[model samples]
Target: MTGSVTVAGLGPGDAALVTPEVTQALSRATDVLGYVPYVARITPRDGLRLHPSDNREELARATHALEIAAAGGHAVIVSSGDPGVFAMASALFEALETWPGDRHPEIAILPGITAMLAAAARAGAPLGHDFCAINLSDNLKPFALVENRLRMAARGDFAMAFYNPRSKSRPHQFARVLDILREECGGDRLILFARAVTTPDEAIAVTTLAEATPEMADMRTVVLVGNSATRRVGRWVYTPRSAESAAG
Candidate 1:
């Protein structure tokens, strides 16, 4: 009665955005685990056990999920947005590093729409051109490393999507990020602050680096910085598919 583990994405607060594969896995799961709010998204049923933990307990959660699977119980770990994008999939693989090879449970990662894609769509194709996604949380990495990546991405003129931009504890860091972007991408650059995309509380703000403020983003926000070419067409914001300075 060997069991298995499924890492499934719930897709950014919208029930309709969840993929069929993830839905199927959740339907068959004997136990579901995730961060507190993500686990709350699951409807409790008679046979399904829900395990919710704090956001900082990703490794512990992954280990627990694996342990349940190895014990012959079907386990599923849920993540908001795609699990592989700065989410549970990486943490699960990291936990597997110490897992005994002979007893490793079957694992599957099912994809879902990530925040950037959802945000981009709502903002009218701001990510239609070359782009990069960066998680701004300094929980697992150094602030200096985050700054360096930000500088490089701006220097490359890549449209950028940012996740976990601000939280209560590290409120000041996002201000520094805005400063860095202003330095590297210039003050006139276009920026979009998309908060709680597709949910009932959704709000989208389009502005420029000069006008962008740190308070515009909270943990639920996904920020987008367009390359020099990004602009408005009527009420829509978009970066064209071709580079601004490209040769014929």
Candidate 2:
């Protein structure tokens, strides 16, 4: 009995946001694996075995899921938001690269709404134009790399969405990020912080680079920095669709 590994996204915090495809995948899974909170979202069942682990154990978890699949068990790996967006999908492939076994298990990836899209929707169409998403965690990469990306994005005038902007361990990095943004985008550039989005504790705040501070964001927050053309209409923040209108 050949088995398979399914990587599914549970969406953001809301159960309503979870796609039916991902839900169906979970229902059919023989074993489920993911970070603790994401795995906790899965309901306990008679035949389904849940493997919850720490966030940093992604590669090991991916390997374990593949191992289960190799043994003819249907393994599902869950990620909050989209699995491909700075989540388990990449790690799964990385684990697969070093697999010693010749018979590789079947693999599938299911997409879901990421925090950037969810946050952007709640705060209005700040990403209506060209945009890019950057992970600021610096866990697997250098802070200098993150800084360079920020600078390049600003210089390119791209609307930017940032993930893992701030955490307790590196509280001050976001401050430097804001300083750099101020220098590149200037004082009037709009920046929005959407925290705990799609949950009961959700909060969204929009401000300018001059007034924005590091304390406005956290690990759960997705930050949006708009281009010069971004502005507010009524209460919604949006960037113009036309470059000529944006320039004018």
Instruction: Give the TM-scores of the predictions, in the order they appear.
Output: 0.97, 0.97
In candidate 1 the C-alpha lDDT for residue 137 amounts to 96
Candidate 1, residues 96-121, lDDT tens digits: the string is: 99777577899999998999999999
lDDT of 2 by residue, 166-209 (tens): 99999999999999999988999999999989999999999999
- The ten-residue window of minimal lDDT in model 2 covers 239-248
Which pairs clash in model 1?
Answer: none
Tell me how many clashing residue pairs each candidate has: 0, 0
Per-residue lDDT for 52 in model 2? 95
If candidate 2 were superposed on the true structure by all CA atoms, what would the RMSD be?
Answer: 1.5
